[model samples]
Target chain A: MSIEMTKAEVPGVPLLEVRDLHVEFHTRDGAAKAVNGVSYTVDAGETLAVLGESGSGKSVTAQTIMGILDTPPGKVTGGQVLFRGEDLLTMSEQERRRVRGDKIAMIFQDALSALNPVLSVGYQLGELFRVHRGMSRREARAKAVELMDRVRIPAAKERVNDYPHQFSGGMRQRIMIAMALALEPDVIIADEPTTALDVTVQAQVMDLLAELQRDFHMGLILITHDLGVVADVADKIAVMYAGRIVENAPVHELYKRPAHPYTRGLLDSIPRLDHKGKELYAIKGLPPSLTAIPSGCAFNPRCTQARDVCRSEIPPLLDVTEPDGTPIGGRTSACHFWKETIHG
Target chain B: MGRYVVRRLLQMIPVFIGATFIVFMMMYALPGDPVRALWGERAPDEAQMAALKADLGLDDPILLQYWHYLTGLLQGDFGTQISSRREVIDVIGDALPATIRLTVLAFTITVVVGIGLGLIAGLRAGGKTDGLILFVTLLLISVPVFVIGYLYQTYLGVKWDLIKPTVQDSEDWGQLLLPALVLASLSLAYVARLTRTSIVENRRADYMRTAKAKGLSARRAVTVHLLRNSLIPVVTFLGVDLGNLATGAIVTEGIFNIHGIGNTVFHALNSREGSTVVGIVTFIILVYLVVTLIVDLLYAVLDPRIRYA
Candidate 1:
């Protein structure tokens, strides 16, 4: 309880806030704009699901916020990542490092690759305590067992000595969660945590994550392309296309009526049991290459409702309203024809 | 592990026997008559030659002579040299200390310099230091070992007069230093390239990123997570090189005039001392077998994935 007290020091400031962030990868071809002017905020106990396809910069945004971006090829061209009103980008490397795995922990998508193959599970988990808290080896090991049991790994004592290869996929993910949870981080950015798990195991891991998030009251920014997964856990949904957030809204409102054509296409693309025999629906063209995104809107090429205005003039992200002009709070769409999109 | 070591030891027997037997055959197959060679250009009396051949077991068939040699070896007898008429066992014992000293010093230099350069180059990959290490190692590797040995002998030994032109006493560590370095140079290059490559490859591994994400300092991440995994292949290479250093450095020994196993074998082969050559070659084969066995055992210690059954 004392650990949770520090984050609430500033009442109005969110746990984490990203404002107009831009990231680019310097490829041989050109500087590819991986994340362009992306912004969002997540308070403690909130889950903001950043939804997008593989190259939509969803993971890049999360990585940038965590201060773990690979700097040589990838760079933060502009904007700030604020944790409790302190800009992470402006902080020194040593200061940022102190924040990592302590204030802002992360869980990677692939547990097998993320966890060191040679080290035992206990050692990896205990490392957090040893490094950040300066705990003794025996104390850290006991904390590791406590953490493993907290994640519900059966017989934590017996399995703690096992290597990463010894565990099943689900168990490995549980260990990953255990590691992320080890230091009781204030905010955890889980990048597609269940994308590699079995279908049945996906729900178990997601449920475990949700339960833990609730238990710890930590801010979670869940990044994934899975619409169904987002619908359940996310309080807010931010749909991204070509490095920009095209739409942001409360989860239920966005699903009830999408204000952006791209979000509509994504919702329609989800395969359903009722439409079993029908030819599946897919969006008209692929997402644009970051290096060569369209002038006005990055999604204009794939948008079915793209117009002459959309091709020439870049649309600012404006708040969405019902056809009768009843604006929904926090519902903004970056589209030239948001009115048409919502009405239709 | 104990059982595995015992099993591995037992497996070396056939390898040892096959190696020694081949050397025995090659010695007998050499194009000269051993007793006649021992007498030089002068002809001995026919009866005296016959008596000497009988005493030496040279008149017996090849298989019978091999059987006699094997029995004597099993009874801890390496037999007497037909050339010097000296005890073969005593000669090998005298040469061993020098070879061990030279090889051990050489191995130490190879490890320290090779691994240190590799770590620096790998950590600063694509930097100026990395390019310099790559250039130097490439230069070392392409030149032949004998050429390297001679160059060091001529320049550092004779021209500069920094050390003796040839080793005055093999037991004097300072005298053996230059020769040891020449022996170590090629293998040092190989180890550096291997360690650098391993370090570069493992540096990009996902676990290394995880280590950084764990709030570990860059030094801790590299030393604990990266170095341990990267050094496995380099250690294996080092093991094989250790075996080679002790026995296969005949050229270096010749250049330095060091009375080690290489020098002993070179003189024995030249004088057509069949028994002496066979005895010394057999001892070298044993050393190689023991070193390689130790290397195999070390593989398990370095990597947890490989468990001996």
Candidate 2:
């Protein structure tokens, strides 16, 4: 069977676009609105960092995009995941599967758990080529070694036969990256890829990922809770709280002037050498439960700038403007007082 | 690997000795004496009784008798059957092949049907098909094996004549089918349930999700990724049940009148022929030992993390 390649690249079209995505979990406790009206776009050669703490629906949106959500617990009630002009959510399962790992791939946080323990790393990597490309075992093995080498694995040829457990944590993460890169997909969604590694190894892995993304010019969606990890690599950042993107802006602009109080708290929480002796700043409250999100702006309960307007009415993701009222392109915040917050 | 095998073999020696010792002691402690059972309704005179005891070396001390038994066993002499007056090994050798044939066929059916049903059930978990399979397996597990065997014999053999009620000889393999099916039913249910549970658990594992993310079809993911890991536990259970399966042949054999080792042992137990019973029991123990060793070796094959030190 012939594999379907991604649709021909159109210069103006975004490589990947998610529009008005809504995901819910029909759990025994209640229906949880895990993702509500989330939207984003990634160009061919840019990294989009989805920043959020655990349970903020960042991974949920990513899973929905990949068509991997467990349906009984997770349902994509409304969404469109468009990859190269074709909406993946509307494709047949067979068609979607063809798109998965071929057009879009995902790398999980725990490399040790993600890789099949019983299989040799080479065999696991080679499976993509064999299944999708119909390559012979010998060809797959050669390609596996090449992919391993491409990911900067030391002694790739000798280690090809080693199982996942035989490799160190960082090496295993590299192997995961290598597997995702094997088919040369157009987009790669890495969900907390470095969360399980040591500090130094995390940097190495992130660096490798960033360098590879540049090499392939693939759209990279980096889903991470650690704000520090994405500052160097992300072109744009979307900060999620209570399953909603409260702030969206260019990475440098977000760091310089966070238009939402939640983003400002996240930026302040990061420890620095200059602020050594004091307690690190922490956001005041836990995220609202998805099952019972606050009525208006979900972040209102925790926002220092919360007003009666913030509590009574939901804030839309309005475009952020300068003090002189010139709109910043592609910058939006779901906060009523974003103008003040950005200028504060 | 060779060293591991040799080490496992060496370990089996003590187990074999201990098992044989237990069987021997249990027979000695049994209420009915083999001599009395042999002379049933015929009282032997004092002199005749004494002569018989001396002839069989029953007059020797217990330790000396055990020594003789051990020495004879070491030389591959399983002593003689008290009733038939034939060598115990010769009797077992004659019956062992029939038992092996019946057990192998039954166990093979058990594995194939069990795993197939389990795979279907696991893949369609929470669906109607999975519910039906689970309910049927549970019902099978709840019912006694003999009840199942007799039911099949009545309906399939006696009523429908799908299989011969009894075998004419060891070569009459066709007669073994219905009995084999009966024998396999309980184990099949057990294996199916175990496999379903294992596959369900493995299906939720991160690696399986990774397999799907790597663009594998769901069918391929379950077969290639989930099934192998799930079989590890099922294989272990099967290995441990090997002796139980062998002895299960006894009941099935008796019901069907198949002259297997199990049938011979059944008669020996009823007749209080300790030597024949001990010999067969020891042979079953050996089979169990060998099966366990094979299972341990299979672990290394199934999971790469397990290696022979």
Candidate 3:
């Protein structure tokens, strides 16, 4: 279904583009390929939702893009993660670090554990201004309060001195978001930002991200297992299956008609409020082991519509087209019977 | 905090008594008699031996002897050395400052130098500097204290003239430097390694990633985020090391010419001066207790997770 959204024309150049990225780890047992040839692009002011289940290389890919992967267990084996046309993979550690906070920032999951427990919320927030901008303590403190207020923290000025442990989980996540926005980076990668938070707080944080993204026009990469999150905020969605990008398309188009089996499985799995008390659909079988991947398509054994060809040869992401045949994300999916699920 | 201090002080009673009992038993159980040693190799007649035994209350049961010692200690009246006639308190009092001076200086040097070196090494963990520090620390830890003391005296003290040498009997900085260096070397290296491991671990903690994501400099990330948290374990190690450090200083003082408590204890033993020996042991126990208390207090400060309860 090559149905490209007419809205694909992002002004100027794409803010971030990932091409054929592969990340591996050498353990005592053997090498584990965490991310395998994943590719996508995030235009300026766009929100790219990397949709995946647990252990689908979502967090690893995000950490890799953020330049914070544990070196011993994680090595960027092959990849080109281009941020503003600069190859992030090839850059020196120092150069990558410079871009890490200044140009690109990351918001981690588990906000409660992410912020330093000993430090006050104000101190953690003020650190960004102090380090990159070299702001004075008083000035930084003032700006930190402003950021807290901007993120809608109650009693922002008063509670600025409160430590992370003092804040609620939602408040802590808001603080994390505030810190990420402190430096005003060009790109923000929020890896499962709301997983540890309540549904209400998740929606609030997601809404805050949308507002901030619109305000800053920064390329926001939202990595999540929740389809509901991407439905509202994501401009484009990249469905990942066993470390590989199985499908890529605009959010509206993909949600209206998912082109990949994995994407379809994911959409079906969500317990929609509209269909309360209905039997919840779930994707069968566990995610593949990275150490010993399947012979062909990593998701073949789990995919309901997988054919003999799917078990023998990996189906490359071919452009799926509607009757009119418009290109979408310049790509669609890698499935033999994607049309059956999409048009069913 | 006041309640905690009061409670800790109350708890020390049984501990000190237990320690005293052990020291008393060990001293009595030793192979030779203080009377025989004092009287010389030639066996003394009953009159002289009896006199010596009476003077020491050797006629009293071991429990009574311990009770008397404990009471005397409580009253600040530890008896005089049998041979030297020097009061145990006076002897230990004179030596305490020197031992304290050496240990204090050594500890300060260890913390400042060890932690600084460790922080740098940890910040650049797996680098050449880290490997070099790890190698040196392992080497230092492996070598015995006596060997390091004598070696420092022979090389740095005498030959290289990095520090001046003093006469064997002189109570001077020149002689104290070698002993101090020797005494602190292992602890320095150990603490450095501990700090390195701890700081490296903290540097890799999820919170540290948050700090960097907040645009903190690499230096700030290690210093502000990692070091403070890492130092928690180091504080505990220091606390435990206090007892071992005092014991190790005995060898250090003997190797150097410093007339500290260790040297006094050594001479007291050689001369069968039981009171002086007891005095030195009691003083060490006190120092150990004080150091442990300070470290516990520091732990509360360093790791916010710890509480005095």
lDDT of 1: 0.89
Per-residue lDDT of candidate 3, residues A1-344 (tens digit):
11112224345646788889999988777998889999888877889999898878988888888878888879988979977666778777766766777788989898877888777888888877777788999999999999999999999989998888778899899998988888788889999999998988889989998999999889899999888888899988889988898998888998889888888888888788988988899889899888888978889889888778888898788887874666555557888776676667
List model 3 lDDT by residue over B1-309, tens digit each: 778988988888898889878877878777777777766778678898888789779879999988999899899888877766668788888887778777776777678878887887887899999999999999999998888877877888789988755436344655565667778899989899999989878887899878766656677777798778888888898887867777887888787767787788888777666677777887788878887888888887775556676
Could you give candidate 2's per-residue lDDT for residues A134-226 as a string of tens digits?
A: 999999999999999999999999999999999999999999999989899999999999999999999999999999999999999999999
Tens-digit lDDT track for model 2 on B1-309?
Answer: 999899999999999989998898777777776766667888857787778778888778766777788789999989998767899999999998888888888998899999999988987889999999999999999998888888888888789977777766767667777778888988988899899989899988999889988889988897788989889899888888777788788888888888899899999888878888889999899889998999999988999988896
Judged by DockQ cut-offs, the docking class of candidate 1 is: medium
Sliding window of 10 residues with minimal summed lDDT for model 3 chain A: A1-10
> Which pairs clash (backbone N, Cα, C closer than 3 Å) in model 2?
none
DockQ of 1: 0.69
Q: Listing candidates in order, what is each one's chain A TM-score?
A: 0.97, 0.97, 0.93
CAPRI quality of model 2: high
TM-score of each: 0.96, 0.97, 0.87
**Between candidates 1 and 3, the TM-score winner:** 1
**What lDDT does the true structure give each of the candidates?**
0.89, 0.89, 0.82
- The prediction achieving the highest DockQ against the true structure is 2
lDDT of 1 by residue, A71-188 (tens): 8889999999988888889988888888889988899999998988778899999989998999999999999999999999999999888888889999999999999998888899
